[model samples]
Target chain A: MAEPVHEIEVEIKNVEGLHMRPAMQFVDLAGKFDSDIHVSNEEQSVDAKSIMQMTMLAATCGTKLRIKAEGADAAEAISALQELVEVKMFDETPGK
Target chain B: MEIKKGIAVSPGVAIARAMVIDSKDYRIPRRSILSSERTKEIGRVREAFDNAVAELTELEKDVAAGESQIKDIFAVHIRYLHDASFGKRITDFIENELVTAEYAVSTILREIASHFAGIDDEYISERAADIYDIERRLLTQLLGDVRRGVEHLTEEVVIVAHDLTPTQTAGFNKTFVRGFATEAGGRTSHTAIVARSLGIPAVVALEDVTASITSDSLVIIDGNRGVVIIDPDDDKMAEYEKFSRELTEFEVSLGSLRDKPAVTRDGEEIQLLGNIEFPDEAIMTKDKGGVGIGLYRTEFLYLYGGSEPTEQDHYEAYTEVAHHFEGQPVVIRTMDLGGDKLPYAGRQAPETNPVLGLRSIRYCLQHLSMFKTQLRAILRASVLGDIRVMFPLISNLQELRQAKMILRDVMEDLDEYAVPYNPNIKVGIMVETPSAALTASLLAADCDFFSIGTNDLIQYTLAVDRANEHVVTLYSAADPAIFVLMRSVIHDANKARIDLSVCGEVASEPEYIMLLLGMGVRTLSLAPPMIPEIKQIVRSVTIKECNHLARKVATMDSQRQIKNYLRDAATRILPEAF
Candidate 1:
């Protein structure tokens, strides 16, 4: 059986760039799906579910990210992560 | 007499014996564990990790709910402890490489931190600090016997440290630790905030305080001026001793004046009030027999809490202090901010000569909306207790009229909105500038009361920047020029039939009490700790004698002559005080 793979690209928009807080949120979201999620910049890729690996990517504001998910839940994982990066989860003020 | 300067984080002057606190002395042993002791070494590492996690969890819970940032920092520390990669790396070094748990942990963390330090992104690189912090905590746990902190002080001493962690600062012993000076910290650092909340004098950001100050050497922490003096000569020591004795003796004798009224022997009553920066300080005011709050510094509302406070914030703060007074006048000064006290750079325009430029009343006038918000809040707070709205640094009648007009506008808006407020809140002005002092009669005609701000008045009158050490010697409140100005202002206030008070450092000393009393300042407001001493002097002197002393000093031509005369008069009247 072939595993399904879903992929998407997101540009960082936060004023402080892709800092610890955003990376933490991204990892937390990745942990929710039963997929092997990988986030990457142009030069490097890392496991999205690993905080240390995600931090090692060192992405900043305006940096483009390519997210790939591979599993039965790959589509859902990719969609949720795309939405998180687009809406800038953990960046915007709460209740706004 | 080598003096070092840092940011003054807390107030008050403390002179005590110095003690060095160097947490770096907690060294870790570098030895390989034998294969036979592998199980024990593994157990030791596991125990260290378990204890570290438990301590962090306890620390997270112990932190106040408002300090969420600190809680988050502790959370990161816990995460590092639970990190599988970090644990595997350390365990591999201990089991396969034959190294001690302490050495393995430190070496692995150091390598990881150095790797992070090479990251181009600042946010990613700063994670190196987090790694270092976690490394130190784990090392401390692994080498338990070598732990060092302020927890072991046995006697009162001034702590000189590289820096203090929030946990260590929180556990400071007030009885054994007179004060603390640190090599790193800004005014808003956790150590500074905790030191201030504890009412302990602290000077931070002194780059080499710990290295320069030796243990058991006499040291002075002038938190008020942000200056630290180490190993003073005999002359300087004697001077500081006399100054310390006056404050200590005054505090000790305060108990006697608890039941006594602040009245002259000639039966003239005087109001002795406290100058407070925070609402909680009102408790000290009431404890020290302060009849009212003469100067409620409102600038702290902006400086503290990490943001510009809203109208609701000001209202709540003013209401809390007002409630403490129980109808006694709580004179709230509108934001006397600028110069070195500017909180945000973008909010205020930068100036070359901040002291002589946009500051205090000038700043309030320039920023009318901000000023009106404070006025509206103050008006709303007046219903809770007796609230007097006082403006600071009003050098001209126009500034007063403009400020009063804005207050009127705020009151009208509140009325239109059907909001409740006190309509007849007493309005007042601080006589801080020479121009303000000269025009005291005109200001008194418009204001309901007057409070002389001798600190600024002395600086402005002598054309001296009080903070500039080169010219600070010339800045004297006891100057003959100040005496002349005080006499004129008192005469004007008397003619205008408005209440006048002295609310400055000058009013705190017993020597200046008689001179101010002679100058017809019937009310005195100072730091809460100085109230009892001033009250004692107020109770002992006759109004006639004070008047004579004032008259004699007013004619003196020099600061020395005036100071000597006042000292002689103070000794004669209060022999026990000398």
Candidate 2:
């Protein structure tokens, strides 16, 4: 039997794109799910739970990323992680 | 006069033109060095890094407690501050290129900053600013002059630096520099402590003081009141001039009391002494009508020079002070280093509650070799003058016995080597904790004399941390409970026939002088500048009057009541002195 897999694509809304702090927040959200999540940009794909790995992707503003999850909570994880990229306004409050 | 308030670090008054020296403007002269000098260069780099980390860590704690927004910024900065990669890279460059560590650090920081700036991401680009701030701070440390921008000034001026390190304060030219004002520092900072020792007026933690006050602006620093006046008008200047004249007159009057005995109206003689730190300060003891050096803080031997002081270093320092005082009793306090004192490199573990943790005599007992070295040095220097060895923060008689045992061992070593010392040198303990005060009778039997350090005794009894801003309101030297403890200690010491003295700042005030005299304390040790006024009060008031006031004050419940009563009594007794 093939494990269930769900995927979604969302644009980086924050002006800073995947900066250190925002990337850390994204990794923290992904870590709360029971599913294995991976985020991929145009050049590379990395585990969403690792700040360094996600930073390596360098998903800037207006850039698109494919978020994939595989597990029993694949659908919930994909939707949650996608919501952070699509709707969560990490950029609403400016950084120093 | 435009007055600015800051935390008072040292006491005095100074009128001088401002000399603003932003340490950020400091630039290192870039040059290559020989391999033979690499070792020293490496040591410099390590020290600079260590100091930066310690400084930033302290700032981080402050920021985290309040401003949450900037706390994150410091978080990121501190993370990189301790990054192994950053340190390793700098050390590797210094060793491999054989260049000065200053040059290497500058080059590496610039390269890293440029790399971050070159990134397309704005978040990464802004990190370049953090790198720059770090670079400047590290460079400032490497300059070896915490006074980076004005290390070699020619004229007299009030130094206005962002902050001063112990090193910068040490390098101050007393002849040229009138005083100092800093934008960031605390009352307990190493710079402040040094300033107090040097008797230089200083005001610290005046936010943006360096930025607001320009160089060449006429200024007056009243460190006693913690006020700084920049660019005073004619009216204000006239008023200050009159004030200054009166001050000089008052100082002359105090000098007149130098040769007078501190005898009460009833013919009760009191032993007045000065508490000192550096060896040069011993002269002030005699000038201030002090008959002896009551408290010679020895922590500076370990603190001033980042490295641990050698046995010979301790010997020379003790011998110098002993010579300066002639035959006056010089009380050299052993290393009170662990808590809020010397932050010796690689020795103390980071303490959570330092005041309650390993400190003073306890720390000395743990580190026996360093303790023995100091004891041996003090014993050796005893022959030069009337010297006394005082152990600080002794909690119980067992600790005293343990300390005395170690002293005995060190004395035996000196005897074996045929070293000369005063065999009957008086031994004492600083009764700084309530536990020691409660059991003073027991401890009094073991020691020759007792010096009540009311500062810590009050703090411990009240369960208050004096330095903690949030709980500082609860710390009071005049609290009724403190009086009870002090009375008990005084009674016990008197019963044991052991001489006792009050050496804390509480003893320096005229109000406390009367109260302490009433409590049967006959010896007083305080800061040199305070001795004159206190002595003047002692000379006028009778022991009978003081005892009456003390009996009344003991019944007061609140600190406010006790303070008000003492204030009125002091004024009534010393109308001329006031």
Off by over 4 Å in 2: A1-96, B6-11, B18-144, B148-211, B339-344, B347-349, B576-578
Alpha-carbon local distance difference test for all models: 0.78, 0.78
Per candidate, the number of residue pairs that clash is 0, 0
Model 2 CA lDDT for position B554: 78
Best model number under lDDT: 2
Candidate 2 lDDT by residue in tens digits, A27-89: 778878888888887777787876545654666677889999998889999888787777774
Please, what are the lDDT tens digits per residue for candidate 2 over residues B101-183? 76688888888777667878886677678778888878878765435435566777887766765445555565677788887
Q: How high is each candidate's TM-score? A: 0.58, 0.69
What are the per-residue Cα lDDT tens digits for candidate 1 across B82-158?
66666777887888867666667777888878878897767668878887887887777865522233456676788
Residue B434 in model 2: lDDT:
90
